[model samples]
Target: MVDGAGSIGGELSPVLEVGKSLAAPIWRQFMYLYNYSTNFKRLEKEVKKLKNTRDEVQHKVIAAQRNVEEIKQNVKDWLTDVEKTITEAEQLIQEKANNPQCFKRLCINYKQNKKAFKLKREGIDPLLQKEKEFDQVSFPTIPQDIWLRSSEDYLAFESRTSMVKNVWDALNDENVYMIGVYGMAGLGKTTLVQEAGRKAEKDNLFEDIVFVEVTQNLDIEKVQTKIVEKLSIKFSNETERANKLYERLRSGKKILLILDNIWEDIDLKTIVIPSKMDRGGCKLMFTTRNLDILEKMGSTNNFQLGVLEEEESWNLFRKMAGDVIQTHELNSLPNDVCKECGGLPIIISTIAKALKNKSHPSDWKVALRELRAPSPTKFMGFLEKEYMKMAFKL
Candidate 1:
């Protein structure tokens, strides 16, 4: 009889343990439900307030007079998280009110409710802080006199002047955004663009004009640094530099970004120029020696810079060569020397400067002969072709 009673007790022990486990969860659920019921009104009030705050933020984001695209996106993500938490809390409240019998279900609902409350508490402060930041943020002002101009005189011939004028007109046109100026090296592409920038500044066509030189061996960091310096914005962290640049430039202001000397196709976004030009009224004007690069950049207008005409080339040479060519005997010699330069302004300017101080006609003759020699690679190919032509003609 004692063994039978002991076996019966052992059999009941498992059942008792299960009952104990179930009782604890039941009690915990009861307490959790009581507390939740007591706080439900307050929680509802807080969530309502949070929702109203979110709505206000949304309205401010939409109605604000400045560009807040980055901040707005951040706010959007935060609100989405908050909304998910709110939905979870609502579902947990509904489950608890139904008095679920499963211990596991109650335990899960309780933990989830606690987590929801914690999330709401943790999220609200940052949301409010960001709201304050948004309130205080002042939109960026338009940049002025940001165009970099050379100290030397920009001589614009008839054709070159027409090109410059066309560029200026395109830059101002609301429809025309990107302008490309392409030509052989040393046809005065840089000088012509510089002149256009100066005129645009004087006319106030854009709020800001940023000039950066993107060379053949592109250094992205250097380009970003130059733009940062022009914008006068301080930042740390090289990894985030591109993002910072985008934020600064994305503000709603008409910006003219002049990228000089683009050799190949470069992703503008990598250099912090927004891939899409829709940010504010931002426009891009780049100079390249190849037309294909302009096409790659999606240029809306292209201007090919031609070499100076024979008469124009002589005039530029005489101006650069100064008083040496004014002598009666050297007059015809200067014209002959300018002819050999093949109307390339760089060669004409360089040779004219070399002959500036020399007075003798013999020196002029010697320089003309040197100009006709096969030039090194750095010299214009057109000059080489011209030399070959003259040699064949002779």
Candidate 2:
């Protein structure tokens, strides 16, 4: 009985040791789960607060976005209203201008007939007052916003407009003091710069805008004279002119100096124009047919003007052709002529002007033939004759 009791006790001892090990791990797992649950309960209030704040912020953003859209719509409506009013006023003025003879007769009759004079006064007084008011309306107070003199045959196209925008943006950048616009001859480089100058002036970007033409021959004296003349400054001594010009430019106000049709590099210092790095607010803009000229002049930014796209070329051609193009019999001929123009504004405008009064399809065909096989001597002779005709008409 003693031996059996010993064997049973030895087996029961190993079972008791295993039970102790399992009990210790179970107690540790229970404590870990208890701590994790406590932490989650503690964070619950903060998580709720964060979600509420997020919702409030989202609502505010939506409200702000709505307000912005409302303001944009209001501004758009205002601009539309102003544009409509201006159009109506312009039409009225044009009508009055067109019937000047009728208005003169009415005025003379009003002087002789008392009853008619009273009725005329009633009918015309308001219009006259409105006309006077329109005239008196202050023109935009832009300083020296002059369109640089150029050939009136210039046409605007998308590519040219995009280049202008790029130049404008570059000029707005404080780092860009000198900008160069280069293109092939007769590609409307002069007109592009002129438009940019006009826009900059209207935007009040500069205090003074001066345009000077620098032909193939760079005449320093002539350029200086023109600039000083535009500034209303006089300096008699040739040597002191540079100093005078520099001082004038340095005198507080920003100046935009446009040099058109440069054929070669120009030393800005020689002409008394401030260099790109010298002046604070003064800016220099020049156009050349050669990109290398811009590099020589130390241009901070340069833009190359390209020809008009086919659609833009066609639109400009049709506008220039005017009533002559309305004849359906001349279909495809006008398009062919425009295509032959090779998107050159000068050629297109000159040809269009020459054909402005003619409606015959044969006349266009003849013009197209000449354009297709233009003889230098013959074209020059034709242009001279046209110029004389235009001069006589003027």
Candidate 3:
């Protein structure tokens, strides 16, 4: 740059001095070509390595896709197999439930091919391992004597030996005695049947006695479960519940089945009620406020459980009010209370117990007067208005 900017006095011209640079384009171009070639080769090598890695990854991805498909197919196949086994199990159970002999045969068959059946039935896919935890098998428990509004009716029936014997014979009869006990609420229809259950058990009339409550909210599955549980059948899944119940029940063992508190009409065929062969000498008993339910259950003989007769009413009342009688000074009040109880044991018993601690006739009179008033559990009005209506109509 200093040489190019020469002094004006004695220096060379600036334009002439600046034009003296070396012209070496040919050498620079050659060097550039050589470096480009090296860089191109290096890029080619890196591209080749990337291609190799991509090929490996693609192969792995293809193999993984195939494996996933294979797993899916295996699961589907296993599910198909399981469903088939469940269908067969259910059919077998239905057969056995209908006939006690089939139950015995199924037990034998199950023992023979337990492994094959399990694999065919449920354990085909390991993914469904948790499904085994879900249970359809419930063994029946010895139900406590928790009589709901039916105990008193049964108690009254116990006093009638002829009626008791009639019921007993009908239950023991071979032609599947379907006895219906019909009444209104608090009239003791349930009580009568429970009393019959106690008697049946006491008399050793059957190999087993089972009670199934068909509540107002009736589910056939629940009824089926109750029967199965009572019978103590071992079932592992929903598909097996019905079959297992049938197989366990088909032994031709004389059994008494109590169907209690039936609210609606249920189809016997749908519910798997035993026919002549499957019945195994089973007797079916039903109690309901709905006579329609009784008719549907095929009650050959229906017993209309009425309010306690006057004497029976007094018997129940005196039993409950003995404490009241002892404590109260006026003896006339006991008769007054009984007269007002109106021949309903439950109402009389409940009121008598309520009045047991009170001291005065005024309290007794008030209780009696209240019962006569428009209120729930109006003991006297129930006989004249409610019980008679239910007895004749229901």
Highest lDDT scorer: 1
Candidate 1, residue 80: lDDT: 83
For model 2, residues 30-117, the per-residue Cα lDDT tens digits are 3333232232232333334433543443454456555442223433343344344435434443443454324334432222222222
lDDT of 3 by residue, 150-238 (tens): 34333543455566577777887777457887777666555567777877777778777888777777898888987877776778996
Which segments of model 2 are wrong by more than 4 Å? 1-156, 384-394
Q: Where in model 3 is the C-alpha error above 4 Å? A: 1-159, 326-331, 375-394
Off by over 4 Å in 1: 1-152, 377-394
The pairs that clash in candidate 1 are 143-207
Shift of residue 290 alpha carbon in model 1, Å: 0.7
- Residue 222 miss distance in model 3 (angstroms): 2.4
lDDT score for residue 2 of model 3: 22
Better of 1 and 3 by lDDT: 1
Cα lDDT over the full model 1: 0.69
* Predictions in order: lDDT: 0.69, 0.63, 0.59
Candidate 2 deviation (Cα RMSD): 32.6
Clashes of each: 1, 0, 17
| lDDT by residue for model 1 (310-387), tens | 889998998988988888878699889889878888778777777788888887887777777674643334234433
